[model samples]
Target: MQTGNLLPLVLALAVLAYGLAYMRSRAVAAPLGGIRHLKSLPFYYAARASLWCGLPALIVLALWVAFEGKVIQGLVVSSLPSDLMPESEGQASLILSQISNVAAGKLDPQFVPPEIAQAGSLLENLRNQSQTFKAVLVLLVAVLGAAFAWSRVAPNINARESVETTLRRIFFVCAAVAVLTTVGIVFSVIFETIRFFGMVSFWDFVFGTSWSPQTALRADQVGADGSFGMIPLFTGTLLISAIALLVAVPVGLLSAIYLSEYASKRIRATVKPALELLAGVPTVVYGFFAALTVAPFIRDLAEAIGLEASSQSALAAGLVMGIMIIPFVSSLSDDVINAVPQNLRDGSLAMGATQSETMKNVIFPAALPGIMGGILLAASRAIGETMIVVMAAGLAANLTANPLESVTTVTVQIVTLLVGDQEFDSAKTLAAFALGMMLFVVTLLLNVLALKIVRKYREQYD
Candidate 1:
């Protein structure tokens, strides 16, 4: 049995252990006139038995799978003659790849030296032995854990307490992992950004007006120096996002208000799901629509109106992005409006307020926090959108307020910078991290500002 097959077998063993423990617990409690005499329910005892039968075995299996390849590679490398021993990590990696290919029969032994061929044979044998041992060890641990838990299924034991404690520990570990992972990502980006700043002056990258990042291969080449200015990108990002919010906010909010306050339940039922279907449409499909349909229409319309518009323009991307986020705003706002207390509506109505007045003064005020949250989410969606911008806005990074201009955003630039094989030492590659850090900072500031506004409004409502 291999590690993959052992996983299902371990689960099967856990199920068997649970049944046996459950029956035993019932038997022990039966003489005492029912399960009421047991320290915990039979369910708890069975659950504890299942945990004992599965958790340790899974841990061992995970450890084996994680370390098995590395351990085998180290042994094979160590067994090589001094003349064949790899001098660096790169050489070791190359040797390992060749050995792997040879062992898998993708490369014939005749194509490799005798030492490498021997190492391949050893690698295959060691892997086979490791799999066999791993299966046996995992099964042995599972049976031992099951037997131990089965013996402990007594009336005096608190199986529920033990199971709860284990679950609490698991939850804590999961939360810690999430927090640590976020911290790790932030630190990694910060470190790379610092490295990038060392090579390119912070003032130049931040304040330079030019948006080029193509460094020449030779010093004598034309335009050897690359510009790492981010102003144009950030400007385009905000311009597109502002346009998207303009189109999305009022339309989405108004629709949500009508759906929640005035529309019949049957209409709401028919319309809400259909509106939300926009959110389910794939972004690539939206990209294709924007590229093939919207951009050309905008360009031709602008021309007809005696205005110049790029074939790919900010207006087209923003319009499409706004349409995409309508569902997000509407769905969230409708839920929040409906969640406002019914008493407030009745109170306003009893005071002789009209339906519109009641909505504006009572329900909307009460649901303002949630409504703001929906708007904020929509704004974020617009800011982070890349596919529509790439297809319709063009990747030009022009620092213009005009919606008919060709433009690109920070996200599109970042994707372009990191598209293919890259060395981190180069400013072009590191520039992506710089852009990312700026975007992160701007987003954090937006979130903080939104929260402060929300808090102020919330206090007024309270």
Candidate 2:
């Protein structure tokens, strides 16, 4: 059966199991002068039975779904004649694609060899048979588990313990899955980065000034040698991020202070959510704003001021990105400022300090750690942003600190490297992974620093 269809059926079976076990629990308790005589509640008994009916079936179904394609493909490949067998993984993949295409009627039968046609037929048959067996196995397991749970429903059975243990294990499994997924992503990037390093020297990538990643397909092509220098990309990233932080930090921090410290309840309530709506605006919209409006305006302004500015400049992207991240800083800082002990503020005021004085001397210092954390988080968001940089900050890896000039960020270059039809083995494509690894490292360091600052200051307050 299809997974979607099987899931609903399994859910229905679990519901049935719950009902049956609940009735049995009530019936068993009736003879002992009420449900109080039972070791656990009827709800616990119902939950335990539902879990028993669902978990085993779901586990079997998941495993079967995960491995069925690989198993069937292996079987199909093995059935091919030795002379027709694939010699490499790539060849095997191509054969599988052809078989799949033929099975799906996307390929003409007469266009391929008879052996391939026969293999496609076999593939179809195996898929059908596999689905049928999977359905049967899942149903049987659900029934057996439900039956066992039904039999175990007695006055002395501690269904609560069983249910709690199962839930705890499920939670642990979820945590493990999340951790493993992160590990998998990191290792995948690491391996690809290693491949990239093999093609391009690490020192050249890190320190070289040029940023062109275009490699000629033929030896006769001009400028065939691609430069993988990341210095310019990183410089642009930091330059833009600095401009964004310069705009965001002061404005957001001030707004947060006003809302949390000085504003009345009505004003705070009116302004906070409206300000936070900036965060909900789609980044693409921000990109459009930066590209269509901000970039042109900045160029015109710069020209009026007797300075040159690119039509697409870091200033434009940074300003818009700063505006976008304002809510992040404001909301977080406001909450942190509000979390400072009321007694601290009251004590400061009673000691004849002005509101501003109290805020500076007590509240601001107390909330500094959390506010710094918020700023760092906003900095990370600004650094990692792609759309605004792409649309407004032109993709020129100019190693300049001038915000008025066109420059591209690491993320922008990464996107540029991997956007279209590109071979992964090439340094151009693998450079994306290398950029990703660098970004991950940078963001990790920022987070670690933020955590340390927060912890150190948090201890003082505690």
Candidate 3:
């Protein structure tokens, strides 16, 4: 078997071994003696043993899987006859691939030399021996570790407490991993953005009035001067988000109000799922719907009103994006609205307030923070949306407020910048990372602010 295909078998064996060890440990320690029982259960001991035995071996196996081919190929190439070495790296890779296939008893149609066959046989034997040795070593280590751990289990052991502590530590480690991953992603974006800034001044990137990323690569290339203005992209993003919020907020809020306050059990059950279905529809489908259906409709309507509209316009994209985000706003807002104390509504009713007055004056004010939090979340989603904008919004970065005009967003710019074959180090390519960092920072700030507002408001209600 190929090295790549062996990893799953190795992982499956390790997992199976862990399960068996756990069950064995449980069975061995079942009878609890008076006042001498373990502080932790037998299962905890088993799990701990399994973790120690399996985790390290699995990590090594993964690393080996990732780099084993490269290491082995390098060794093989270095040992190859000088005349057999291909002149081009591409050709060398092809030869190596053929060698691998031949080693697995798959004949290469292009080059079936006798020497190649011999080399393949030798490599296959080495691979098989290496795999067997590794598997045996791992099995021996795991079994020994489990046995040693089982031997240590005693009546005085605090197995339950130890297990609880271990689990807590594991949860904390998992949390740390999530946080570190986010930090790592942010820093990676920041580093690349800094590189982009080095090529173009920070002010030019931020406030320049024109954005023409298409620049000359060669000195002789004329008409190569490109503008780095981001004003248009920012404006387009805001415009689309605004249109979406306008479409979504009222409809979503009203739907939330009806669902939470007035809808019967049957209606609530049917309507909630239907609304959620909107969220499940893929964004790519929305993109085509915007481009094929919504854009054309908007253009025809504009013509009827004696106004001009492009086939691909901000209004169409924004409208579709808004429709997409309705669930986000409505679902969250509904929950928050429902969370408002029933006693407040009861008191308002007793004081002769109408339902509308109570909702408008008391419930809404109380739920405003949470509602704002939901809106901010929706806005963040709209900002990051790509496919719909790429399809419906034109690529032109026009810094105009007219919804009928074609415009682009930061996301669109990022997509365009990185779409084709790209050199990672180029200013154009790195600009995507800079835009990403900015988008991340903006979204992060909005989330933090929204959370703060929600917390303060929640404290007031408490």
Q: Please report the candidate that would top TM-score against the real structure.
A: 1
Q: Residue by residue across 209-229, what tens digits does model 3's lDDT show?
A: 798888778757874656777
lDDT of 2 by residue, 1-462 (tens): 888899999999999999999999999999999999999999999999999999999999999999998999999999898888999998999999998998889998789889999999999999999989999999999999998998899999899999999999999999999999999999999999999999999999888999888998876999787898999999999999999998999999999999998999999999999999999999999999999999999999999999999999999999999999999899999999999999999999999999999999899989999899899889989999999999999899999988999999999888888888999988889999999998899889878878998899889877
Cα-based lDDT at residue 82, candidate 1: 98
What does candidate 1's lDDT look like per residue over 364-401, in tens digits? 98899999999999999998999999988998978788
Cα deviation of 376, candidate 3, in Å: 1.7
TM-score of 1: 0.96
Query: TM-score per candidate, in order?
Result: 0.96, 0.94, 0.84
Off by over 4 Å in 2: 218-220, 350-352
- Superposed model 3: Cα runs more than 4 Å off: 1-36, 49-53, 66-70, 80-130, 341-352
User: Which whole-number lDDT from 0 to 100 does residue 318 have in model 3?
Assistant: 96
Clashing residue pairs in candidate 1 are none
Question: Alpha-carbon error at 444 in model 1, in Å?
Answer: 0.9
Cα error, residue 374 of model 3, in Å, equals 1.7
lDDT values for all models: 0.93, 0.94, 0.81
lDDT of 3 at 84: 84
